[model samples]
Target: MPPSSAQARADTADELVTALDSLESLTSTDPERALASATEVEHRANLIGREDLTMRAQLVRGYALDRLGEVSSGGRIAHEVNRWATEHGHQALLARSHLQLSWFFNMIGDTPAQLEHALRGLECLDEHAPARIRADHLQTLAGALITNGSHEEARTRFQMAEDLAMQGGDVHLQIKVLNNRAFGEYVAGNAQAAMDTADRMLALAATHDFPLEITALDTVASAQMALGRHAEAERTLLSAAERSVGSRGANGEPEAQILLTLAETQRLLGATDRARTTLVRCMDACEEGGLAGVRVGALREQAELLAMEGNYRDAYELHKVFHAESEALVSAERDARARTLQAVFETDEARRESLRFREMSMRDPLTGLYNRRFVDERLDAMLGEWTASGSPFSIALVDLDHFKQVNDAFSHAMGDEVLKKVAEILTSAVTEPAFAARLGGEEFLLVMPDTSRQEAVFCCEAVGLLLRSHDWSTLIGEISITASFGVTSATASRGSRSALLAEADRNLYAAKRAGRDRAISDPTSER
Candidate 1:
């Protein structure tokens, strides 16, 4: 070839490499940048009549679109790239395109498409691709397999990725592999193992100053929460949230997740108001980020709060909305799975169905508020989800004043009537989307998912007034009931869910000490 021709070819090749690097960088952090770079490369390749460069550009653009949440457009671009690459015998580019397609399917939660593309990518690699790229491809495959509930296969793939990453001396790839392995461990209920892996990854990422270290911190928090180490979990989550908040755009999701966790811890501590405030922040962040999954979670927490506040009708409505959104996401995945299997069953579908059944069982027979078991289970789940999402929610421990005196003054039948009437009055008075459950013996627990401290106090006061005013008919004459409420909210100072609960319970006793019909709010002491 002439010198001029050779220089032109070299320039074209350099442009193609630059486009690929830019696209890869954008894949993790900025989809818009990736799309712009890929488009520029595509234009240049077309001008130069370089078919291979054009194919690569098309694949990069498709991957960018997929990350931007434009599934259909990205899929079409991937199809075009596949066609061109196959026609041009560019097997490496074709393999990468397939890998991108697999990731797209995974993002949309489409099991069948994810498996198909992943398998195709593996076949094309055929033991010849660079170790780092092959390891990445395997990691993706492991994630897809894990999501589809193939735990054993996922583990093997993750292990293979780890081995390859270590062999290639790729710290970033190794971190990713460890993170995925931790997820697999979590799904398999090996909480301790998961935590260990997450801790290692977080340490590595932090030491290396990895930009994506937040992900490892998030995983560690999740594992800690699952293990019931609420204090450690909250601390980890808050640190992650702080890091996320300090970062650029769309960083609020991690903060929201952490706030949700703090809320749950507060709720467990009996700081109903504090939990509510945390949840409100979490919902707001999710809304700002346009994170549909997080939004659904926030709504579900809101419904739980409403239920705790005795607004069963509204709670039921909100629950329906939450269930619908969750089902829609699952249905989309199911449709994609159905395309390849005779039948595809999701573990979550069965688990959620069972949960609904259990929820019904936990409802009080007469009052419809949650029973003690329900209260415990709901609190646990709320705390776990909040920790993962980093949002705040709160709880209140309430008790009817002088209940024994009322029962003694009237016949047992009349006492039963009194309890029923009191429950009804409470149900009607505090009708926010927060949750309320009867804890037996005139004690009640209320959960405020997304309410602030002020709002929670207002709610408690409202409930108190309604109870004091409710007319109770007895053989002696008409009477009234009174209740004392203790409220607390989530805070960095509170060590764990139990400590938060203890603090709130102490405050509740303080209210009782001051008088039977008052409310008290306080944060956990500095012990």
Candidate 2:
């Protein structure tokens, strides 16, 4: 006999709630998947007229969205959810909702808002809130305190979180708090304490497949580097990078940092060729992972390498590019922080100014495509979402075929016109949910979220055909422009965003090697 409708609905609601609670485990590791699951819960809960579950799902969705770089979108949803949770007297939901808002504010660099929401979350915590929720709230409060320059209070909060984790026997949470403690110690210039804490974190992380393992290794490597133990630092970072190979990597930061530091160690050892190789690898990973700031580090390393090789002109050029890009990035971050304030104050003037500054900050100044900074942030967000939810995303690295010859044959001014036309064609190929960016010089990267490898390959082929058919002679008589394309896609078992990108870069290189005016995609790696 089938169950009654009431029984079925009750069972379904319980199942969703269980799933919703489990989402916390994946929140830091795979926000995309969490968001997808939360959205599913919201839809099903709404279908059953379960407002409580729907609100709960919405709160989780907001948190996931905030982590995945949709901070503004998450902020709005969290605000609504918080109000609903408060009015309904749902203490647990209210605590979690405040936690979500805190995360959103933290992402946008609004330290005050982060602290406010974190305190609010603590205020709402009661017996109704789970132990894990309380632990998370304490961790957020600690971080907020640190941002507020209250180190002693932050240390106390960390201790409280550690106590809670210990009481709950949550190895994962314990490792997380330990890693934070190590980082805090390092930042406070207590290298020895940081090393000891990192060792403890590593021991705990090794006993389980916790997400903090790579970060613990990084902490150890950082302490070693500070102590001038170059060989030790190099070995530790190598281990960290190896572990990071198949992971999402410490909220999207550890892998690149590990490799960058490893390269620095090699450079210090006077291993010029080895250091150069590592820097190249670092640059590729940085580009693929959309780690623009880390890419700047890679660029600086490369510039240093060139200077050591006595190639002063190229070295100087790279340094100049690095400085300009770094300043632009700082300006962009400041504008983002301002926008967060604007949202809070409900000021139209601040909003308008922020919009203008953002546009200026993201545009390439040439070709009008998004710049490297925008692409990096978007890629980081998309990767977090894709990794979490198992959604598909494709990336294409496009290189203009014979671009140098174009510059040599025609004047640089004429070559500029050709690039502009190519940019126009590339921009036309991307629609909503698809974006293209100039990664400086003659290369561009196109990203399509919710697109599979096959779909992306088809799009790349179409772009190729369009360029081949374009009337380039109209701009420069008898001269034609074409691009080499390489494509890769995300999958459930994908190693890292950098690996996905490196695969695409390899394929793009293959496209160029195969004859120049064609598109080639990594065939074996698709899901």
Candidate 3:
């Protein structure tokens, strides 16, 4: 006999496994080539009808897409693959799929989805899952946690990842985890600790790993910036950005972030013209590379610089554009979360877990309002409904006036009380088809569906007046609690959710400029 069919199938599977192994080496080195190779593997696996091979190929392909700045596309692929793996009852595939999805969201600045998906992946990992996969999941989850302001838990996760990576003898995984740990330290405001960690990491990666070294340098620059060493930060960031030149995903992403920081440092050093040039360069790079997060940063920096240059009108318009882009980024992340949820909610166990996770993730832990993630998703959905049904909707961006003074006079604890009190007011005020959410510190997004701009303004004015008149002395020792509101309605002029939110943000900025403790719906209206 020439060959048995079973033997031939076994040989083919071996070849595919080897191919997958080889392709992974190209991920940091040559992501474009890795993407092409992954496509080939997927094609062959589909023709062979090998579910295992298909899942493996898809995992790598999704990773490559994310690396190439196609995060949304990669997330969709990961979601579909996860659904297939679940249907096939392949536990290892399921874990890998979740891991890939987690990476996609992480790349796009979606920390909540990153943490949730990473946890799901870790939960699915069994003995059959690779040690490397387990380590990666732990590292990513730790990073997401750190970004979400969970320092202690993130440190614990980072330690676990470090231990796992050490046990597996994977230098790459160890270096990646170390970089994240350094960044975590920086985020915790420990500039000295972060610098020390990054220095050690730089030494470790100096000889063998260009990508890791670049990341370490970025960390060092961040710590320097935190420590108020603008000149040192600028020099370090310039070096990192220069070295990042040929490393598409590995270095390109950091280069963008580094450039933005470099520009900020330049601005702080009073090199206004130079800062503008650097920001322009950053914007161009981000646009060409499709780095949405980086682009938003560039826009914000440029707008700030414009304002500093006494170009108030241009700065305001630029800030409006920045707000629009930022909203789009948030919307993209929400869509990614929706895809992950769709893949997960296929079984009773998964459905229950998802419900619990959403309850935790969607609400701001401090204020009990819907978080920015929820706000973005809801805004996008409402915009779509408004477009389709000719229904009216409006948004108000509410920001507390002189709130920092209260925090300084009392404490953040008292400040938290104030926020909670405001949250309570907004929650109580909102009725059916209307909701409120905390956008971030000292800011809230109030949305009203099926309501005109005029009606929305009325509600916002009432809230603003209520806040101005609220008896905050009982909680924070006689501090005034006033808020400024910006109101905008869905209109043909605002084509997208981002545009609509941007309009509201512009109006809000106008309200603050005129005077605090007021609501402004019309941009042209005199104060």
Candidate 4:
């Protein structure tokens, strides 16, 4: 007798569960294959119409996408899973989802959101949670806490994570924790502690012969650099760069970061020409790999190199430019308070929670600004609004030039502070009818309702001035900020959201190419 349809469906579910496990396992080492597998699994799960299978598949798929460097899309899917799991009482998935969101925020340099999600992830875990998951959660939470400047709590969490990893015999996880812990100690300005941790991690890696990547080496090099052991750091970084290139290929962020450190060491060693050449190569790698964080360092190194050559005039000008670029990292604490006020001002429990969730879903948790999802959905509606009222609607895509360096040179805490400050500036810049949103990364959006194209351009110009003139020194010493604006209007292209954004993006890049810290509007438009 043939198996019943119910039996077949049950068997398929069992098979999908197995597939999900395998898919998750392979994601880091084989993201492309994992992504392909995830796509198939998602399709099959959807066809089955089983929430259990569908959610699990999407979680793995999101993880795969994150591993593959599709952070934004991966985060969106993970966020969906988070919402679903929260509403459906799927505790485990909810925790994992939070972890995914934390990682996503980390990638985008959204430290506040990363910390928030990391905390939430840990809170969601229960006694029954798997040892590996618990260990990872602890490690993530510790890293977030360290980034946020909570050293005592971070140390406790780190110890717990370390113990869990050791007890579980997870050599790799233990190494990851050590790498992060060492970096965190360095960021905390504890060179000795960082060096000690790095040594322990190296010793462990050597004993096990784990194919650990160069993050630990980079931390050790950084510690050596901090201690003024330039020659030692140079040698270490050179070895790391060579090994990383051989194992992970050239032109990746890790390798680029290592090259950046190498260049800095070379500069310190008085190899000005070699430093310049390495800086050039590092900049190229950064550009190719979109390593904005490392690119900041490369730019600053340019200023240093110019100074080394006794080109004071060019060096001073370049230093000014470098600091201007660094201004993008500013005050996240204020963003949090604003979000809290928003939540508190909402009506009754149910309505308040609903509004909170709605806002959270639409807003980028890091900046407390409307996210891309909100932009995508709201732009069409705003287009309709302008179409109906016969008024004007304008938007400008603002990108922070050399913003990633804030996180790279200084600690992420400083970077978080900088990002928040920028959001605050943008918030203050916009009026009631005009609001700002963070589109992702270091990009922001300004939407002006009932405003003409000319008006929007003028507003953007003022914002540029505000950003440039603002006292960024209070946040990151001797730094200033500037952004490139690509402004567009409904009158120009009301057909679709993508069309409007594409034009603005084009003009934005034009401004970037033309020289940054300026706003540009479409000159061809019939105003």
Candidate 1 residue lDDT tens string, 1-527: 45697688788788687768657756666777878888988898888788788888887787777666566667767766776778877788878878887776676555555766786888787577778888988888888767655565577678789989989887878898998789788988889989988888877777888765566777777788788887777677667767777552434565676677666665554567877887888888877876666777778877877777788999999999999999986776566544422111235643563365355457653356777777666676676665676666667788888877866777544665666776776666555656778776578887776665567778889888887665565433665678899887666665256765777789799999997798888743521
- Please estimate how well model 2 matches the true structure, expressed as its whole-model Cα lDDT: 0.80
lDDT of 4 by residue, 152-241 (tens): 557667878888889989787788888888888888888988888888998999999986667778888998898898999998898888
Q: How many residue pairs clash in each candidate?
A: 45, 3, 0, 9
Residue 311 lDDT in model 2?
Answer: 96
**What C-alpha lDDT do the candidate models reach, one value each?**
0.73, 0.80, 0.80, 0.80
Residue pairs with clashing backbones, model 3: none
> Who is ahead in TM-score, 2 or 3?
2
Query: Which residue runs of candidate 2 sit more than 4 Å off their true CA positions?
Result: 1-7, 208-213, 246-254, 303-317, 337-527
Whole-model lDDT, candidate 4? Answer: 0.80
lDDT of 3 by residue, 1-527 (tens): 68887778778888888999888656755678999998998888877678789878877887787777666667778887888989988888788888887776676555666777777788888956667777777887777777777676577678778888888887777778888898999999888878777777777677565455566777888888888888988898888878877664633566788789889999888899889888877877787777888989889999889888899999999999999989999899678666655553456755775677667578775677888878777778778888899877888999999988976888655777888999999988789789999977798988888887788888988887788778877888767788999998877778487987888899999999998788888553321
Residue 493 error for model 3, in Å? 48
Q: What's the residue-level lDDT of 136 in candidate 3?
A: 77
- Best candidate according to TM-score: 2
